[model samples]
Target: MTHPMALPVVRTLNTDRHRVALQVFMVVVVAHWAEHLAQAVQIYVLGMPTSEARGVLGLPFPWLVHSEWMHYGYALVMMVGLILLRPGFVGKARTWWTAALLIQVWHHFEHLLLLLQALVGTNIASRPVPTSLLQLALPRVELHLFYNAIVFIPMVVAMIKHGKPSDEELAAAPCRCAPAKV
Candidate 1:
């Protein structure tokens, strides 16, 4: 018998509910991507200075760009969301989802390190800013863009695969991502 606590979680991740949850998660992920892309365009395409190139929401709340808490919170959300939605995936979708989850886990760790440094008042490499390890090689903005890209690509692939699952995958899936017969 399923544990009482697990029953709700299992139900949430099953069939139609899982698909709806995934859709909501994907919308959030895409919105974040749009923000990052907007920031990048402001920097490269529009020739705006980095400080002035804050994305849509960042333009209104510029402090968000420098807020380690905000960054860490988003990272944590991504990690948790990926994990929670993972059980709904099967076969190739599961593989791709796992890949995204693994990358997001590392991304979360980097943000966590940055958050800890911020709390302790010691930035990485004695730099003035909170620095991720990769930030040493690339600017923070560019580094995040790369990280998001890598995570997003596999996630998109996973969604595509989920939509047109193999017969075995469809059989294994508790959710209905596949199309119905005419």
Candidate 2:
């Protein structure tokens, strides 16, 4: 005869697993959305006129856009599997969370430079803005900064919440694949 307590313990564990999965999903989706929007604005709205051309930041524009989506998709799907299939990842959630924030920070800077060029470059001056992306009268530079602060800031906060660990806590965590005794 088992104790009645066993079922509640099982339910709590399952609940935690679901919560972690959702958190991971949100991180990936948000990252992909930002990258896609940035790419679309530059390529379709700015009218640089060629997908093969380099972006203002000197990146091959279409390649950057395509690669960003592919990378995000791969990471999101793999992370979901890791959370569900692998027990160790849950315990090591901090590492995964930090990695997500780091990737976003890199992307934030990349887009920042592109926005700067779009607002001021003579090359862009000749190209008429598309009605679909944004009105020409709006300040593109300010808009970019505002979006960076509003959208990416939350992602950074979530990453720090999920990933950070005290020095002592990290020290106590066992090293991967402990050496076998002779």
Which candidate ranks first by lDDT, i.e. highest?
Answer: 1
- RMSD of every candidate to native, in Å, equals 2.1, 13.0
Report how far residue 159 has shifted in candidate 2, in Å.
20
Q: Please, what are the lDDT tens digits per residue for candidate 1 over residues 1-182?
A: 86422667755765558888888898989988998999999999999999899899998899988889998999998998898888788999999999999999999999999999999999889999778898889998899999999999999999999889888898888788678534
TM-score of 1: 0.93
Give the Cα error of residue 9 in candidate 1, in Å.
2.8
List ranges where model 1 is wrong by over 4 Å: 1-7
The lDDT of model 1 is 0.88
Off by over 4 Å in 2: 1-14, 50-182
Report the C-alpha lDDT of model 2 over 1-182, residue by residue, as the tens digit.
86322455433333444345545655765664555455456657876544543333325444553243344444445344333322222234445544544554444444443444445553344554311123244454334334445444554444443344344433432222122233
The C-alpha TM-scores of every prediction are 0.93, 0.28
Backbone clashes for every candidate come to 0, 1
